[model samples]
Target: MRRLLVTGGAGFIGSNFVYFWKKKCPADLVVVLDALTYAGNIANLDAMKNVPGFEFVHGDILDTKLVERIFTDQGIDTLVHFAAESHVDRSIHGPDAFVRTNVTGTLSLLNAAKAAWLDRGSGIPHRFHHVSTDEVYGTLGPDDPPFSEETPYAPNSPYAASKAGSDHLVRAFHKTYGLVTTTSNCSNNYGPFQFPEKLIPLCIANILDGKSLPVYGDGRQIRDWLYVDDHNRGIELILEKGQAGETYNIGGSNECMNIEIVRLICDLTDLRFRERASLSEKFPKALPAAGRASRELISHVRDRAGHDQRYAIDARKIKTALGYHPKESFEAGIQKTVDWYLDHENWWRALMDTLCFSKT
Candidate 1:
């Protein structure tokens, strides 16, 4: 069994990955390292506390000493690097944090891994898997083909640029130090335990609260939306059978417009309210609870600064090479996501009181 250290394990995709990994490999030791940032919630992993071989460490990835200590002390054989400052609007307002955490923090992890696994000559087989984003390819023309692994880096936002930097660092470590690394640049992800600040969760939360569903520009931006669990499955395959020093692109094969997604969430939430009488009592303020449409809250706002037009992923390499493919269709995945938020009000409500979340 692999002794794994997962960074950012309290956040959206990371937490989901942690759960997925544990369910598949019950005997493997899974240690989570998170700083408990605005997005990271320790409660995400609360269900696993009673399980054996599970450990949680509250810390920053930038702290090389602490990271190396965890590596050496825990005998960590695999490092799944997911810790990152990943909000687009936040990056636009405050880019320093993104650069510090994404670029410098990645370097720190690389150094710690190199020291613990290579420098000591322990001869332990190891791997460093870096999770990246498809935004590094920038926007796409309406008729242009989807982004492939060979797409040139042309990041438009500070968040994307910072992630691109980290991706380069991972490649450098593999080439220069032979760190046995693999990277996956995945498309947009949505599922349970996601921060309410993101599109799907944000819309679901706002719709329940009878708040405006803010749409940027014309709201026609296209994106390939990957379910969070499917993204994790791709990573699992890569870790099991992937070649070192290569990068994989993971996608959901769902290309949808922003406004279409907002409308879908609104329609789905309304359906849930209509189907359950208890929901109206729980969330009386919801428009659907009053026999009105949730889509009435739709409000068009100013577009984001430097918003990318579209992003679609060409995931053939992973599918052809390692038999990796997404299992969830958008219709089924979105309904499950909406139902999760409806059932877990306390989870997202606690996160809603934050100063940053209020502004968003």
Candidate 2:
């Protein structure tokens, strides 16, 4: 069994990956390292705390010493780098943090890996997999073909640019230092344990609180949505069968407009309220409780600066090379997302309160 070290394991996509990995490979020792940043919630992994072969360490990726120690102490042979400052607007307002975390922090990990695994001829069998996003390819025209592995870097936002820089670092380390490395750039992910700041979760939280649903621009921006577990499965395929020093794109092939997704969530939430009488008591301010439509709260807001119009991933490389294919469609994924938020009220409610997100 592999000894895996997953950074950012307390965050949204990372937490989902942790769960997916442990269930699929129960014999492996899984050590999670997270900074517990604003977006990283240790509570997300509460259920897995007592599970055998699972351990969590609260720390930062930039601390190269701590990372090296983990590599040596835990005998970590697989490094899944998911730590990053990921919000676009936050990156625009504070690019320094993004650069420090995404670019410099990635470099720190690479250095630590080289020291522990390669230095002094230790030569431990190791794999460093960097997780990235399709935003590094920049935007696409409505009719342009989806982003392929050969897509040139044209990152639009600070977050995307920082990620692109990190991707280049991973490639450089592999090429220059003979490090075994792989990178996967995934499409938009939505599913359980997602922080409410994102589009789908934000809309669900607002609908339940009877708050306005803010829509950016004309709300027609298109994005490919992959369920979080589906993306994690792709990662598993890469680790098992992928060649080192290669890049793979993972996507659901589910392209949808932003407004369309909001409306879908609205309809789904309304349906949930209708199906369950207890939900009305739990969330008294919910739109369905007042005989109001969730869409009625949709309000147009100013568009974000440097917002890319669309993003899509070709994902042919992974499917062909590693047999990676997302099984969940947008309808199935979003329905699961809606139902998750409905059933786990206390989880999101506590997270929202801690983050102090304005519901009004």
| lDDT (0 to 1) per candidate | 0.94, 0.92
Tell how far residue 212 is off in model 1, in angstroms. 0.4
Least accurate 10 contiguous residues by lDDT in model 2:
351-360
Backbone N/Cα/C clashes per model:
0, 0
lDDT of 2 at 208: 96
Name the TM-score of candidate 1.
0.99
**What ranges in model 1 sit over 4 Å off?**
355-360
Q: State the lDDT at 128 in candidate 1.
A: 97
CA RMSD of all predictions: 1.0, 1.4
TM-score each candidate.
0.99, 0.98
- Name the 10 consecutive residues with the lowest summed lDDT in model 1: 351-360
C-alpha root-mean-square deviation, candidate 2: 1.4
The deviation in Å at residue 143 for candidate 2 is 0.6
